[model samples]
Target chain A: MLSCKEVTHLLSEAQDRKLSLTESMQLKLHLMVCKGCTNFSAQMDFLRRACRGYLTRDTPRDDD
Target chain B: MTSDSPSSPRVTPETLAALRTDMLRFATLQLRDPHLAEDMVQDTMLTALNKADQFAGRASVKTWVFTILRNNIIDAIKLRARTVSASAYTAEGESLDAAFDTLFKDNAHWSPATRPVAWGDPEDALQDQQFWTVFEACMAHLPTNTARVFMMREVLELSSREICEDLSISMSNCHVILHRARNALRTCLQGNWFTASGCATC
Candidate 1:
């Protein structure tokens, strides 16, 4: 199982692109019991959504 | 598709004027410079007016004008891109914070205080303008250079290689820097808005 730090690093990398199956599986497995890492990943998801909503309220978001 | 039909692109005087305002706001967010954003918006207006026929109603007037503005912003960044002392950029005086040291023991497990709580519906915060204000504040909290790299990657959606080339950093360094940035941002958001009892405050 990946440690919190290891999983968190992969979590950030996953934001840029899809993780490989092995990496995803490892992350998913780690996240299953690690509440802290889960919360951290969820926050990353929120950041992505919040940023995309930065400009385009209805559709396209230029906030990248 | 139906919003900006071929029948009408909605380029009225008032709409164009309003587009300018939106363009300026959008540019300001991307460029983070009011004066530069104004120039960008002005350039966007000029380009749109000149290429009025080219719009073709493929997108809404706002989208078309903002596209011009976005390109202008990118050009502005590229033009100003240059090698600098890493010391100068990272010189915002922020160092690896000591507080983070306590988050992990020798074994790299999360300390008790470091355990994050499950945040409630993030969508609720997304819909709140105050939440954005708080988020912007959190983003601004990062050291200036770190924030720039983060924006170029996440905001501009630049590839990792593009970031390394643009910032003259190594690939691994770019990855490390992004990890730091994401960590900082996620922590701040969790503290301020994501917790079950978080104030959701600005």
Candidate 2:
């Protein structure tokens, strides 16, 4: 099982899709058994999606 | 508006305007002050003109302007730091560390109203005015040096080596500052912008 610390870094990496397949599997396995981490992972995934959106958008204007 | 001068390369009117707009945004992101940002942009233009020979045509004109603007930002940060009270710095350090621990370690404890957005449509959320306000606020809360590193590395998208040279900090310190900056921004955005309600926050 991945410790909370490992999962934390994984979550950060998962956003950037920097995790390897093996690490992803391990993270998935750990999350299945850890409710708190499962929720945490879900939240990170959500944030990654949102921030990616921001990155893709045009340079924000001052008026907006 | 002329780059035709014998000593100074004529900077086209169009090129100057583009440079001004880009520098204004880049500098404003660092200082959060429009007036100061404009000044930095102007200074960058002046530098670029005076040292036109240094423009090896290596980096794009925009990148060159950004480099100068970032240097100005670091100088501004150092100036501000010098004036800040020691106690104020200490309090910021202590308080921000506690905030980082709380926000990054756990999410379930956060109120539902502040939960992460479902993130189904990032484009829609990106269009929201509230996002910029929250993003800027979270960025503003970071320690000065940390904020500078983050802006240069992430927002300005400069290389770590370039950031170190620009800020006059070591590579390790750049990593450390970037690490702390990312953590602090992540935590602040979560606590302040992610509305537990997970709705379109204005």
Candidate 3:
């Protein structure tokens, strides 16, 4: 089983590149059983979406 | 004036100037040099004005202008990379091993206090102004180069290969920096926003 730490690293890496088949399988298996890793994966997705959204969103003016 | 589609948005100097503050902030964050950021934003404004006739309404004015700024920032980063040693771009004072050590156990599981918790339905939070504040704070908390690389990859939408080549880092090093950045930002947001007891404001 992939450890949560390893799973998180792979989760981050998955953003930049495609995971190998064995690595993907291992990640899927671990995520199925690990709620924490599952939540972490979801948050990573949210972060990416939020970053892209940042470009279009209006930031309040800072007069300072 | 040449005949133009009525749907095209008019690009005014005032409109572009209004967006300057945000553009400068974005440039400054990515470049980490106020003067260079100012120069890039100024150049972007000039280019946008010169190309005002080309503006189409398919995207919002903000999006179009930002696209120009993104290109300028990328060029500036590449130029700096060529002029400066690659070591100067390294994430100073940030140790990825130490960061992981704090978040994981000796056995490689998440440490009890650092385990991830559910942050329900973050989509709606994207519309919340307070949420963006927390998000920006989390981004600002990242190590200098990590934030730069993350913005390049996530905001500027640069490929990892382009980033590696621009910063003169190996592919694996770029991955490590990006991974560390995500971890840091995730933990920061969890603590400051989702898990905080008080108001969502950072």
Candidate 4:
């Protein structure tokens, strides 16, 4: 199993590129057993979605 | 003055005003330079106005405007990269490297503070006005090129190779910067928003 540190790095990397099959398998297997990494993955996903909202969502004008 | 598509939302002066305000805020957050962000938003709106007749209503007017602003952001990022290589930008930051090393043990297990807290509904938690205030603060804390590379990859959903081309960095360099960016942003956010209330959030 990948260490939690390595798995967290992979979780962040997975957002930007396609991990190879071996790498993907290793990450998945680790996340299946690691709650911290799993929560981190969810957190990263949420950040991405929040950014998407930031770009396109309408804002109420009149404040700094 | 244009013809009758009842389903298509009209783009009015007030609408553009609101959009310009939004685009400025969004651009400022990503670029973190209020002047440059202002310039980009100005350019985007000018282009939108010049090309208004060409908006075929395929997407909402806001979406159309945002797409333009997004491209504007990409151009600005590329321009900055040409002005300075991102690798050199990272060269002086030994602390970032040390920061990464400190996260793991000799066996590469996570150290205590680096462990992920079970954050709340990220989607909803981030939407809270106070939480977004903190989020922007964390984003503002990133190193310059690291922030650029990170937002391009994670926020704008650009591919790593695209980031490489844009930032004039190699693939591995892009990965390294992104790794640092994520760690720094996560650590900052965890300190501000996650720890005090656990997953209860801001």
Candidate 5:
């Protein structure tokens, strides 16, 4: 089983590259039981979406 | 003003000037230096104006101008990489590991105090202007190189291979920096935006 730390690292790597089948299976198994890791995964997805949103909204309001 | 096509707005000084604030904000974030960002934006504007006639309607004028700015930022980053010592590029590696260590225990599990929590719906936060302000602040918190590389990958939409080559770092190194950057940004956001106590106004 991949440790939560390893799982998080793999989660980030999954964004950049494909994981091996074994790695994928391990990650899936870990995520099924790990609510924290699951939340972390969702946050990663949110971060990516936020970045895309940032790109499309070119003209940010001046109040910031 | 009478042109039927809306994709390509006429490249007038006003149109280009309107984009200056956003362009400067992007450049300033990547360069981490206001003066240099100003210069880069100036250069981008000049290049855009000089080649105004070549502005094809394939993409929005903002996109076209940004592409020019992106290229300029890339060149500037590459130039800086050449002049700075190779050691400087890797200075953040240790700190990144230390950051991860703080989040995870010796047994390689998340430290209970730092474990992730549900952030509720992200859409609401995305639509909030205060969320972007917090997001930019989190971005500003990153190490200079980490933020630059993150912007290159996420905002500029460059592939890892291209980033590795352009920054002259190994593929693994590039990945490590990117991972650290994401981790840092998320952690910051979780603290600042998601948690009730983190932001008084929000």
Candidate 6:
């Protein structure tokens, strides 16, 4: 059971896919039990998707 | 596959389009200004085109484009920082406590027990302009240095050492700034911008 602070740190790293396997497991386990952390992770994931879409639009055409 | 001529790989139009799409997305995340992001992507494409023969295949095409995009964003933000009149002290003056108070102090409606807004809705808000607005506003609220470092590291996907060299900050300070920026964003997004009512929050 990670503290809120630890979970927060893990969430950021997890988003980057930078966590070690053990650390990833711990974060996942904590997320399963903690609704606040789960929601926070989900929000981060949502933001990444939003960013991906925003970044892909408005690209210059290659005339392909 | 190594070519016998030792010449660089050809950057086909398909490759440029893929790179542009990626660079644009990354720049948009960091700049929060589509125009600026577009310009950055354009600049990246121009540079990549000019240096097409420099493609060593040491990294993926995506990684190379992202590196260029990150560098461009840093340059843009640094230029903006120079033009802005805000001093470091004044920028950092908005204490975390004060920011929290400023948002929630007046709102008698805020509840810790409030049901969090479901972010998974297929509505275009999460995909289009509104998300950028919220993201941009949240970024604007960060302290200048903190925001710069965070954007370079997280959104731009630069390494900490790379950020340290670019920003001329120590590694420890870089980490500190990054930590502060992430925490601030996490709190801001959760409390204000991304709540159950969406607008009810940020």
Q: Who wins the TM-score comparison?
A: 3
Two-chain DockQ for model 4: 0.65
Tens-digit lDDT track of model 3 for B13-111:
888988988998888888888998998999999999899878876788898998899888898888775444446445352564466567778889988
Error of 4 at B124 (Å): 2.3
DockQ of each: 0.42, 0.18, 0.78, 0.65, 0.74, 0.16
Pairs in steric clash, model 3: none
Candidate 5 per-residue lDDT, tens place, B1-202, comes to 3455665467878889888888998899888999999999999999999998888767888889988998899889888854543466568656766766788888888888878999999889988878888999889878788788888888778888888888777888777788889988887888788884562211
Q: What is the TM-score of chain A in candidate 3?
A: 0.90
TM-score for each of the candidates? 0.81, 0.55, 0.90, 0.86, 0.89, 0.54
Q: Mind giving the per-residue lDDT tens digits that candidate 4 earns over B1-202? A: 7775767776666567777767887798778889999888888888888888888777888888888888888888787776666546577345666776776778887667666778765666655777777777777777777777788887778988887877677887777788788777777777787774332111
Worst 10 residues of 1 chain B by lDDT: B193-202
What's each prediction's clash count? 0, 13, 0, 0, 0, 5
A26: Cα error in model 3, Å: 0.6
**How do all the candidates rank in terms of TM-score, highest first?**
3, 5, 4, 1, 2, 6
* Tens-digit lDDT string for candidate 2 (B109-194): 33333323343443455577787667767677677656665665665556777765655666655554554555565555555655
Error of 4 at A19 (Å): 1.8
Ranking, DockQ, top scorer first:
3, 5, 4, 1, 2, 6
* Better by lDDT, candidate 6 or 4: 4
Model 3: residues >4 Å from true position, as ranges?
A61-64, B1-8, B82-96, B197-202
Lowest summed lDDT window (length 10), candidate 3 chain B: B84-93
Worst 10 residues of 5 chain A by lDDT: A55-64
Q: Compare the candidates by DockQ and give the number of the best one.
A: 3
Put down candidate 5 lDDT per residue, A1-64, tens digits, no spaces. 8899888889988887899999999999999999899999999888888987885664554655
- lDDT values for all models: 0.71, 0.58, 0.83, 0.76, 0.83, 0.61
TM-score of chain B of each: 0.79, 0.55, 0.87, 0.85, 0.86, 0.55
* RMSD vs true structure, all candidates: 4.9, 7.0, 3.1, 3.4, 3.3, 7.5
Stretches > 4 Å off in candidate 6: A20-22, A58-64, B1-70, B75-94, B97-111, B114-118, B168-176, B186-193, B196-202
